[model samples]
Target: MKKKTFNVLLLSVLLSAFTIACTKDIDFNQIDDFEVTPVIESSLIFLDEPANQFLEDGVEISSVQDSVLVEIFKDAFIKEHLVKAEFVFETTNSINRGIELRIDFLTDSNIQLHSFSFAVEASSTNTPTIFNYTEVFENNTLESLFETGKLLFTLNLKPGPVINENTPGSIKLKSKGIFFLNIDNTL
Candidate 1:
């Protein structure tokens, strides 16, 4: 009986040791696999979104400003509508910023001449000094450049530099405060 009890005790101890030996703790620090890809959307089905509008003397318009109205539709611009002109300058004298112009259409019976004039007054802002043009706006010191009655800075602006030293940014305009001739039908 003593021997059998000793044998049973030994067997129990050995089984416990075996179980403890089988138990283990494991640790991991690395993921097994991974992948990456880029997303692209080319469907032209978006709601009214702001265009990255910009202006330049001669470059991409997107490099100018944000949400410019005058650029997309200059020829068909209406009166009382506000718009922005763009300027891209890689030089020290940069006047390509904040060039705001107002448009007014005249009609004989409802139309002005195809050729109307405008005025360009120097704003209280830090406008660069305008140099020489006509005897009227010469001396390069336009304390009030350039004044005409009817319009503000108007003279056939297409693409490219509007004025230079010789032209002096002429304010093609009428002497009277009102530039557009409202044609009365009583001829």
Candidate 2:
């Protein structure tokens, strides 16, 4: 009976100590200063065209053009949070002709806002030649980027050996966009 009484008193003391434990005050306002910077990478464009695609009826087609919708800019949240953007392009050519690429940023009503161009050298051997280019948008350009609704790409072939239906090489292009965002709760 004495041992049982001692065990009950020990349990009561432990419970009482836990109930009276002290805790420091917490400041919920600290969350107002929290901020986050995030980087996002996404594939923007790709193309693989056989040499013969540049020829039609034994005549070389000097240029070919295409466009894609920039859907991410349609989001208001993305526009507000985005601080910078970068576009990376890689092109590999196995054809015997150098090429020039023209890129244009346009709005919903087909108004051009910005344009840039780059050139890719021709490959002399069966091994393909690779070219890389990067375009960055920030500060004053960021506002124009937010207004972009579409991108136009034009590929122009340089004069060289003629390519026919039986040509043995192709030109390939791959590109991506990197986005930088700053999100602050205080905003």
Candidate 3:
């Protein structure tokens, strides 16, 4: 009787151990990425002619003015699995000319959600400069915007304090941007 009882106990222990070990399998999550490029004409900045200021009918003024509104990719970029997002601005003409650049994310009502600025000095002589700006929306900022389809990108160019008042040099800044996004298993 003693031997039989010992065998039964040993079998039970082995079965429990095997079951527990099998249950501890590894869990993997999926990731998705979205990227896009926005258009902005640096040559059009600080145009002195009136003809350059006005746009044709049915044309969007955001393209020619000091600010440009960017359209976001709503279908692919969701908030559920968003791990990180970044905007990288690169240009070869980032000369230190006291030029101020403002980038903002806006709502449908033209409300500012988030913004950042970059300044170039006057002393800089056509050196390649890049601005890698990262913005993480707080309190479901991105989630709600995505739901309402009100997300927008606004870029503004301003003259810095050190800029010459009499003859401010024309800043032809051609810039490009890449959006880096990390999404979770929702891919």
Candidate 4:
């Protein structure tokens, strides 16, 4: 009985020492820095009287197919791994006419990455009706967006009729985007 008791006590001390030796401190130095890009904003106006209101530089209009392509940002994103992205689109309607808007994001190669659609209420009293939309992207999904290089915006407008032909209404769209980047030490 005495010998058995001694063996058990020795086994307990050895087991405790082995457990303490296996534990180590965790290191969190893998993340290097966080960077934020400046806000990018753009706007476009659509008029009924002029018919082709999107004829300015950086704006393209196709009357035959009723389409509009506007380059909102040219190489706007920096060369860093994107951690998060937030985009806000605000539409102000002063044209007494409702419109359906289709917004597309394209890569430098003109490949579309994503698209969104929204509707704007008509402004019958000349007061601007505003609508806001927000989107957030994170992690691996955001890294791919930065790899696309430059970003382009393609806008398609389907407008409703004017309340009064004498007093035609117009639409103006305002959009802004912000990016949060990270320089991962592992990268």
Q: What is the TM-score of each predicted model, taking all chains together?
A: 0.16, 0.84, 0.40, 0.51
Question: Candidate 1: deviation at residue 173, Å?
Answer: 12
Mind giving the per-residue lDDT tens digits that candidate 4 earns over 1-187? 9999999999999998998886666666534543334443333333333223534343434221223343432234344444567767777767555666665555666677766667777776768778877767676555455545344444444454423324544566566666665544544
- Give Cα-based local distance difference scores for all models: 0.27, 0.90, 0.43, 0.55
- Per residue, candidate 1 scores C-alpha lDDT tens digits across 1-187 of 9999999999999999998886555544223232222222122111121111221443334222111112222222211121211111111112332232323222323233222222233423334423221112223322122221221222222243433332222211212111111122222
Q: Give me the overall lDDT of model 4.
A: 0.55
Q: Per-residue lDDT for 175 in model 1?
A: 21
Q: Tens digits of per-residue lDDT for model 2 on 1-187?
A: 9999999999999999998989778999989988999999999889998898887788889899999998787688998899999999999999888999999999999899999999999887847999999999998998778889999999999888877888778899999999999999947
Q: Which stretches of candidate 4 lie over 4 Å from their true place?
A: 1-80, 147-159, 162-166, 183-187
> What stretches of model 2 exceed 4 Å from their correct place?
1-25
Can you write out model 3's per-residue Cα lDDT over 62-145, one digit (the tens) per residue?
Answer: 233245444453555444434334444432224343345565556556676666666544435444444333344434565543
How does residue 151 of candidate 1 score in lDDT?
Answer: 19
Ranking by lDDT: 2, 4, 3, 1
Between prediction 1 and prediction 2, the one with superior lDDT is 2
User: Model 3: residues >4 Å from true position, as ranges?
Assistant: 1-77, 94-96, 124-187
Residue 133, candidate 1: alpha-carbon lDDT:
19
Better of 1 and 4 by lDDT: 4
lDDT of 2 at 63: 95
Question: Of the candidates numbered 2 and 4, which has the greater TM-score value?
Answer: 2
